[model samples]
Target: MIETIVFDVGETLTRDDCYWNLWADWLGIPRHTLSALVGAVVAQGLDNAEALRLVRPGIDLAAEYHAREAAGRGECLDESDLYDDVHPGLSALQQLGVRVVIAGNQTGRVGELLRGLDLPADVIVTSAEWGVAKPQPEFFHRVLEVAQAAPDETLYVGDHPANDIFPAKAAGLRAAHIRRGPWGHLWADAPEVVAAADWRIDSLTQLVDVVRA
Candidate 1:
């Protein structure tokens, strides 16, 4: 039985349109171009960071990130950014005595923004704080530590197969593939994702029933 559900931020609990659109504006590229490049990179199994390189070769990403922050253009998460089902779904899980954790490959600042939303989750953490990103076994090791539950009893939910499902399953945690975001919808029916994901869901509310099962 799953006692804890750990969710990925982007495309799982929230939409990432704002994040990428900001980057597109910062880089002076059309949102459609950046978006298409993002899809291409993802389809090629390349990290989305590659999109930046594709836009401006030899660019310093960290410098640009700090510049954006300095310009007061940093990421800001609000209620509108959250999925409609996120609140009720997570709240229902909490009511069911199931632990809900929001863990994802996000910045420390994103964690802060998420906290500002006051969502119904037991814990909210990010890769920046942990110093370990997903698709890394050690990251899941840290997740299990944060979860305080056995791998078999924990469920890892996310849209990205490589960064979320694969590593979580390799770490012995059950994985749920949610078909939403670009990568999600693109690979929703892929044989690998289908085989690797213990449960394939379309929305967050399904998680309430998922944990019950």
Candidate 2:
């Protein structure tokens, strides 16, 4: 039985494509250029912080990204973007006796986002705060520890196969892929990437059934 569910924030739970669009707008560059820039940074093999520093000079990339989102939408970037029925879904999960946690590369803002939405998860595991990135067994193991869940009893859902599915499966958790529209298209040619997931769903609402089953 699945006693716990862990979710990835960006792309998976949140509207990351919208966020990326805001970033592109703020940078006054084409969206694909920004995408390519990220690809270039990764191609050079820089760590997250180093890659951000090298590519987005003179800026805290995460902060700037949030600022752009807030400005463009005229609202604070809250965790509501993570799910449409944020409170309802969480309440339903809690009522069903399932513990929910969030595991992601948060760069320090996810806690604030969750707080703003008033959706305090059972636990939060972040790469920026944890000093480890997903796809690494250590990161998922940390979340498993905090959730007090046996790997087999937990389910991990995320959009990125490499960052989400692969490590979660390797760590012994069941994995699910949440396909985030345009952003998911970026991996269209890579079927092998998502092969690690035990199941795949297009929306967060669909997770309820997967967990209940």
- Candidate 2 root-mean-square deviation in Å: 4.9
TM-score of each: 0.97, 0.73
Q: Ten-residue segment with the worst summed lDDT in candidate 1?
A: 204-213
lDDT tens readout by residue for model 2, 94-132: 778889887787765555655556564677656877888
Query: Cα lDDT of all candidates, in order?
Result: 0.92, 0.69
Winning model by TM-score: 1
The list of candidate 1 runs beyond 4 A from truth reads none
Clashing pairs in 1: none
Which lDDT value does model 2 have at 139?
91
Tens-digit lDDT track of model 1 for 1-213: 988999999999999889999999999999999999999998898888999899999999999999999999988789999989999999998999988899999999999999889899999999999999998898999999878899999999999999999999999999999998988898899999999999999988888788777
The per-residue C-alpha lDDT of model 2 at residue 130 equals 85
